[model samples]
Target: MKATQALTTALKAELRRAGITYAQLAVHLDLAESSVKRIFSRGELTLARIDQVLALLQLDFVDLAREVAQATPARQALSAEQEAAVVADPHLLLVAICVQAHWTAAQILETYAITHAQLVAALTVLDRLGFIELRAHNRYRLKVDQTFRWRPDGPVMAFFRQHAVPDYFEGGFDGPGEQLALVHGQIAHARAADFHDRLQRLAQDFVHQHVADQVRPAGDKTAYTLVLGMRSWLFEPFRTLLRMPGAAPGIAPRAQARR
Candidate 1:
């Protein structure tokens, strides 16, 4: 999804640089301006159409790919003030979340009750915030990396923890491409660190695959969230049973007493 999004953003940026309007693109492609807009907004353009647009822009797929490679890595975490700005406005916060998911202006407008002007305004605010660069036809380039994350315990995450968490877990995990897993064990500190490193690599791989799958058609895509976490914890019931001073090792206090 990231690749397609990047291509669309690059095309828009090139179009702005070339001062080519959707109407001009329609003329070049012998399509309606609305059709051209739809194509770019949905990012469902075929390779031939993409090439056609690139030809009009005097560029090619390699150029777009290179631009994507150069830009995708620049997306890093937003500063605290920037995040605070987002959480300040409900619409801005919504827009930020949608953009993080690679949602185009059209997608957000279609999916939400936001008007075109409202969405454009949000994009403009994001542009000013350095979260994205607004381009012609209201398209944008993501300023953050694909692996961009909310600051740990930051306002954004605090919001998610308070609201998005319960909503997220409401999923049944029974549908196609859905899953949930839990495992508990005690391990050496070094081994725990190694496990965390592996989880980080796995997250990176998932992000890569997300970009790779952008080639698939929209109909073939389904939004999925992967929540990975690890922590030292015990069931609440087991907590009270923990061994006390001089208690039998690995035995609950009550059980040890009974023995």
Candidate 2:
């Protein structure tokens, strides 16, 4: 069933690549455009219909199967070990983050202090880790799915908490195209969960838009980060003052202060 869906998706992509619209496809297949669209949408095309469509598109079942095989799977979250490997080397972590942000090799080298050799070495490690497939001339293919995520309490987040978070907070968010909001309110648990879901959707939209805009001229692009988060907590001082009378002593929180 999953393979059927994958094949349907690949076929649709091939149709677009071949400039075959639903109207054209319908004309060729002797079906209405709506019917053709429904067949693709539901992945319910009969073998005969599938062959007819493929013939119209000049593709065979083998070709479609190959495309399905090559289609990138949606990556969820990396394993703890993978996250630890990234965190263990700061330079490697930098390269990993750049790739996540859709930075190309030229862009990375132009923006950062990494040398060609260093960048190649980092890409090689990522290839070994299955994060990417290294190609000729230091080019590589991103293996990360659109849904890829860092583990919530993983090493990557720990690094961010230790370093990036502090630097990010230092920003005034007062520049053009920048704004910050700090909202504190009581809410039902269900409502909080709903808000988190919305934030996740927004993050996905941001990522998709970034990928879509890669075709634009580099000069027309600007780097941006959309950080979304939520937590039920309070600053230590506020929590201390709100402690109930005669409650147990407050414990010191572990500090993530840099050495």
Candidate 3:
């Protein structure tokens, strides 16, 4: 339940979802499978090793942190309501946000104000839970896939569905109605799942052709990260409008502008 543990759990799920097995991941990192297993068992990771794994996987620490920060709107608000929710334990909130963005611990601790012992403790919990796997040298990266599904009664599932989304939309929009529409109206769950699956395949292919092609097998160190996912239909209208030539390059007025 510690922040570091939460992060590790998120990382493990992401790695799994990406189809990167422990053995395969060990090969990617140039480490032995047994070493990898031992590191995770101990839940101890050094910052440098963490970096190498993330690099091999084409994930950036800073970008992932920023993505996490941006994904949680509640963290960005300045009002009293926001203050109460976000300030409770910025560290924990930051961890949650990072998990959402699929970031590494190095990314989370860069701006973190907690003590080393606290950070290590958090990471240990995460490692023990199989949320992350440690490198031979004690650095950690996500072991699960980013899109890994949480059990129906898992804390993460409950937290996101119950707290994160509701808090995000509080006083900002029609909540229940919008939720209903999303769950029942525009796109069904099955269709969305299929779309996501296809999207992942496309992303994998793109990375293999474009990003991976640029890297040599001799540890060339050149890499690019590919984030593959779909946005909701809420942006469909804008996406369609943008395709029109000479469309002013911005959002068109809701009423098509006063002629």
Top-scoring candidate (lDDT): 2
Task: Give model 1's TM-score versus the native structure.
Answer: 0.66
Per-residue error (Å), model 3, residue 100:
6.7
Best by TM-score: 2
Please state the error at residue 168 of candidate 2 in Å: 1.0
lDDT for model 2: 0.76
Instruction: Give one digit per residue, the lDDT tens place, for model 2 in 1-259.
Output: 4977987887776665444688889999999999988999999977898899888866668767766776767567778999899889878999998887767789889989989989999999998888876655665556777678899899999889898887976777777666677666667778777887887787789888886676567788777777776776566677678658445343322211211
* Steric clash pairs (candidate 2): none
lDDT head-to-head 1 vs 2, winner:
2
| Candidate 1 regions with alpha-carbon error over 4 angstroms | 1-73, 245-259
The global C-alpha lDDT for each of the candidates, from Candidate 1 onward, is 0.75, 0.76, 0.47
1-259, model 3: which lDDT tens digit per residue? 5444444444443455344666877887788989877765555545665676567656666633532343321222123433334335545445544543444455456656766566565555545544444433324554445344344344444555666555543432333322211221345657767766776676546434542332234254332323332444334555566656444332211110000
For model 1, give the 10-residue run with minimal summed lDDT: 250-259
**Cα-based lDDT at residue 16, candidate 1:** 59
- How does residue 173 of candidate 1 score in lDDT? 74
Q: Return the lDDT, model 3, position 138.
A: 29
Tens-digit per-residue lDDT, 48-128, candidate 1 = 988999889767687778667766457579888889899988899999888766666777888899888888888999999
